[model samples]
Target chain A: MALLEVKGLSINFGGLHAVDDFSIKIEKGELYGLIGPNGAGKTTFFNLITGVYKPTSGTILLDGKDITGKNTIQINKAGIARTFQNIRLFKELSVLDNVKAGLHNRYKYSTAEGIFRLPRFFKTEKAMDEEALRLLKVFDLDDEASVKASNLPYGKQRKLEIARALATKPKLLLLDEPAAGMNPHETAELMETIRFVRDNFDMTILLIEHDMSLVSVVCEKLSVLNFGQLLCEGETSTVLSNPEVITAYLGE
Target chain B: MKTKSKLIKPYTKKSFITYALLIAVFTIVQLILNFGKMSFMMQSLLVPLCVYSILAVSLNLTVGILGELSLGQAGFMCIGAYSGALFSSLMKEAIPEAMVRFPIAILLGGLCAALFGVLIGIPVLRLRGDYLAIVTLAFGEIIKNICASLYLGKDAEGFHLSIKSAADMNMAPDGKMIINGALGLNGTPKDSNFTVAFIILLITVIIAYNFVYSRTGRAVMSIRDNRIAAESVGLNITKYKLITFGLTAFLAGVAGVIYSHNFSTLQASKFDYNMSILILVFVVLGGIGSIRGSVIAAVVLTLIPELLRETIGNYRMLFYAVILIAMMLVTSNSKLKGRITAYTNKLKGLIKKEKKGEIK
Candidate 1:
């Protein structure tokens, strides 16, 4: 069974169909790529899958379980997480704290325990801190753990966002414009990190990217989107070379 | 070297030491003021200082940490004061010991305020920034208006409510009116003391400090930083907002109980729009998210009039306006704020070094 199955997904903003009749089947452990030009509904499709926007009509299934129409947080708890096109870290918070926010759900303690300084609360908190620090180390941000997330450089901030997402332990990870502002060196590093994350965490990944070099490094399958419809989907080399996709989107 | 994350865990030694220092300082000041035969004005300022400090810390949870603007703190305070006052009044004959009665009254006050908190929070949670502030302001006005005209009387027949006067109400002659129109609650019990007020303030500080170090508190702060990102990470934004707001009201209500019991007479009109704004001022001036800052701001602001004495009477209004503007400027200006933070960090480092020497 496919890990994620979208059937006839559609999202309409007034008269405009921002994402229309989008469907795909992604198997577990596969690295999927989504690419398109500006205003071609690439982000709209992502918004739909992550439950940020309520699709005007569609059904989204994860491991054959229908996940359609759930709110963003609920969908996330059901094992889907995403990074933003623009990095969204808790700007004033410590890097470690930004990651710890994701690990909050892993423990079961009441507010009373928090207020009263219960032993269980302390135990869970210490463990959460360790895990959060470990995640920061993975992104090479451990040294900056105590620094405010906003104070980090642009590339580090992007890396912190991904680190924060991984703290949620999602079975499915979505990367939206992860390499938007990176130099080639950082882009190369991010590609390797993406592959490492999939292999190490054993999770499915779907990334939206304009950096074809980065995409080709990690993504095994590619789906071309243009004008709210799927232009084509196939193995990476074939889809990237499709003449129709080239003229409509990839050419420019 | 990575320092362990202090987010939402239990009390660490560092935080514990800070809290202990605060308590010690407050206790010493209270003792000196008590034993030094302080002037009546100074003595009078103590309770208000504690009460307002409690209010500031509670309001800070919503404004600074949760990043929501609330102008309805006075409404919650008024509810707490009345309900707490009602509890003491009704228990006057039954409970001879004021000590036994105060806790019950405070708890009842906290619960009543939380009830209103939930009621208002349900709708207010959907709003952000200016809209939320306006709606809360409206609610504060509504509570004030209701209290101004609300007349409740107790008789052999039961409780009766009338808008105009207690005389026209269908009740026995022995019946007494608890609230008079525009007069507010008549003759609430005077059972509060400086010691009790100090203890309550300390408790508020502890709970607030611990809350900021809790998992739920971390979630709430995350929402403040970035709602979409907080949500994307599976944090329940609404639940955390509601919880913080409700707890905020609970603490404000406790402050109300402390305030009302200190005086023989209570007026709902005292907790009007200005009261909420005053508390917000303390929160902002104290460095919004800092509990210690809130405590200091509340104390300093409460004592300003007394400290200025004779000149305060002539320039009281102007002085407050100018002071408030200056405080806002200091907080908002990046350079000024940076200097203050740097100075404080240097002082903190010195203190830590001295402490280490002591241990050695």
Candidate 2:
């Protein structure tokens, strides 16, 4: 059974159909890539699935449960987490805290317990701190744990954003151009980290990437989009070779 | 290491020391005033000190942590002040003991304000930045005007609302006045004292501190830091925002209750937009998201005007303007900020060195 299945998902922002009739199915632990030219509605598709913009029509099923128009937090709890193309790190927060924010849904301590400094607050807090540090270490950001997120270098900030997303422990991870602002060296390292996470965490990943090199290396299958509609989807080599996909996406 | 985990702020040794020093000064000053070391003018400012402290700290949670502007905080306070004063007065003949009645009134005031928070926060949270500020400011004006026109009285015919003044409030011959229109609520018992206000302030600080370090605090801060990022992480933005705004309103209400009970007569005019703006100045000058800074700012700023009135005399407004501009210049100056940070770090290093020496 597919881990995620979207059927006829559509959204129109005012007069423009930003994302139209988007549908895809991915098995658990699959590595999928979303590739399209500029203004091709790739990010909009991610937005619709994550409930940032309410879809005008369609159903999104995660593990066979329908999750249409749920609030971002609820959709997150339902096992979908994402990163931004612009690298939205909590600028004022400590590096550790940036990741710890994602673990917010995992705690069971009540607000009263938190305010009162109950043992449960300490127990869970320590666990979260350890977990956040562990994830930061995976991205080699443990050394910068105490630094303000905005003070980190650009590549490290991108790594921190991904680390923060992973702290939520989602079954499905979405990346919106994670390699957009990196040098070749940095992009290579990020691709290695992405591959490592997909395999080690045993989770599904769908990334909208403009970097064809990173996509070709990491993705097992690819979906091509053009003007809010899917043009073609197949194994990476096959889709890359399709004349229609070439004209619509890569040919640019 | 143990000390780091013992408190909400793990590495803020300087702020911790500053907070301790200010709290000690507050207690010492109160004791000295009680001993009649200060004039009546100085002594009377104590209650206002605590009230403004509560107001500043709670408002910081909204402006600093929640990243939403609110100017109707004083409106919530008005609701609390009237509700609390009314509850205490009605319970007076029955409860008798000031101790029993006052606590209940404070809680009721908080709950009442929280109720208003729910009613106002839902629509207001949808608006952001400057627009949100304008709406809250309008709410403050609207609430004050409505209270000015409202009249409440209790008698054998139960409670009644009258806009034609309290004297004409149609009630039994033995009716008791709750609020007398523009004249405001009168004859409420003065059960609030400096000690009670101080205790409430401490509790407010503790709760705010704990909240800033908790998981919920992280979620709330994330919303302020980046709304899109927070939502995409699966945080219900509205739910967290409502909870934060509600809690801040509740604290402001408690402060209002304390202020109302500290005096016998209360007026809606006291909680105007100017008052809201004054408290915001305390928050911004203290350093946004710095709980300890808010407390110190509240106390120091409240004391400044009174202190200046005696020292600077008729040139008070001019002095205040100069001082405010100077502060802004120094705080906003990058070189000055760097120097201040470097100096504080040096002080911290000295303290750590002292601790090591003691261990040896």
Candidate 3:
């Protein structure tokens, strides 16, 4: 069984179909890439899977559990954590705290225990600090753990967002244009980080990117979305070489 | 060494400093009260200083920490004041001891405000920015008007409520009027004192700090910073917002109880739009998201007008306005703020160097 399975997922905004008949099956531990031109409904598809939008039709299954139209929180709890394309981070929070906020549900203590500073609060917080720091260390962000999330440079901010997402311990991780604004050096580092995340965390990964270089190097499987439809799907090299996909990116 | 450093993180040190500031203030006031001759005006302002401080701190939880603009905090305070005063007036004979009755009244006030907080927050939380502010301002006024016209009487037939007039309650001939419309609740127990108010203020600060440092605090701040990202990370947005809204309201309610108990005559009219704005000013002038700033701002701001009252009379408020604007300019100007921060850091570095030298 696939880690994530979507069957005929469709959504519309009145007269316009934002995502139409989009369906994909991601096997466990696969580095999948979703590439398209701007506004090809790539993000809308991610929104649909992450429950930011209710699908007009079809079903979604995570590890054989149907999670179709559940809310964002429910979908996240069901193990699909995603980073935003524009890097939405808790800007005011410290780097370490941003991850700890993501660790909210995994490690538990009631609000009362938190307010009163009970023994359980201490135990859980200590564990969370350790866990959050461990994740930070992986991204080489431990040295700047106490810095505010917004204060980090552009590339590191992207890394911090990814770190925060992984803190939720999701089975499948979705990265939306993770290297959106990075130069070649940072993009290369991000590629390494993405691969490392999949290998170490046993995470089935799916990412949407316009950066073809990052996609060709990191992605094992490729799905090209054009105008809210799946234009092509296959091995990264084959899909990139497809004349149809090329026409969608650079019109004939 | 690692464990020790982990144990005392940056926030822990800041939290200790806040506590120490409070304790230092308390001790200084106690010494002035016991040995030095305190002016009658200054003595009278003590409990009120605590009240305003608590109000400012609680408001900070909503305005600064939760990142919501609420103008109905005074409405919650009004609910708290009335509920607490009513409870104390009714239970006056049953629980004669101030030790027992006052605490219950405070809790009743806080819980009552919290109930209203959750109720109002459900609808109000849906709106954001100016719409939220306008709606909450309207709610505060609505509460004040309702309380103004409220009439209650208790007798053999049990408690009666009427909005028109006290006579509309139609209680038995021997029935006593509790809330005579517009007159407000009168002759309530004067159970609040400087010590009690100070302790409650301390507790409020402690709770604010704890909530900020806790898992829940981080979640609330996350929601404040980015609602979408917070939700994507598995946080229930509505739950955290309501929790923060309700908790801040609860503390405001606690402040209300202390407020009502300090005066023999309790009036809901006092908890108006200006009162809400006054608390907000403390949060703003202190620096948003700075809990320690809220406390100090409340104290200093509250003291300024009263301290100048005898000396300047009418011009005191004019002076107060000038100071408020000056404070806002200083706090808001990035260049000035940076320079201030630099000087403070330099001072701190010097102090650290001296301590190191002493150790060597």
Best by DockQ: 3
TM-scores for chain B, in order? 0.90, 0.90, 0.95
Q: How would the docking of model 2 be graded?
A: medium
Kept native contacts, fraction for each prediction: 0.78, 0.62, 0.86
**Candidate 2 wrong stretches, greater than 4 Å:** A10-22, A56-58, A247-252, B1-19, B156-158, B335-360
What is the C-alpha lDDT profile of model 1 across B1-360, one tens digit per residue? 226633422236546765887789777877787698677877777788889989999999999999999999999998898889988987888997998999999999999999999889998889999999999989988887887887888988999888777676776889888887688776777878788888898899889988987888889999999999999999998889999999999999999998999998888889899999999989989988988888888888877766766565867767877887888888899999899999999999999999999999
Backbone clashes in model 3, listed as residue pairs? none
Clashing pairs for model 1 are B8-B213, B8-B214
lDDT of 2 by residue, B133-177 (tens): 999899878888887778998888799888777666777768877
Which has the better TM-score: candidate 1, or candidate 3?
3
**Individual DockQ of the candidates?**
0.68, 0.55, 0.72
lDDT of 2: 0.87
List the candidates' TM-scores in order. 0.94, 0.91, 0.96
lDDT tens readout by residue for model 2, A1-252: 899999998898899988889899998999999999999999889888888788999999999999998878888999999999888988889998898888888765777787888999989988887888788889999877778899999999988988888888999999999999899999999999998999888979999999999999899999998999988998999998889987885465
What's the lDDT of the predicted structure labeled candidate 3?
A: 0.92
Model 1: CA > 4 A from native = A250-252, B5-14, B335-360
Model 1 DockQ, alpha carbons vs. true complex = 0.68
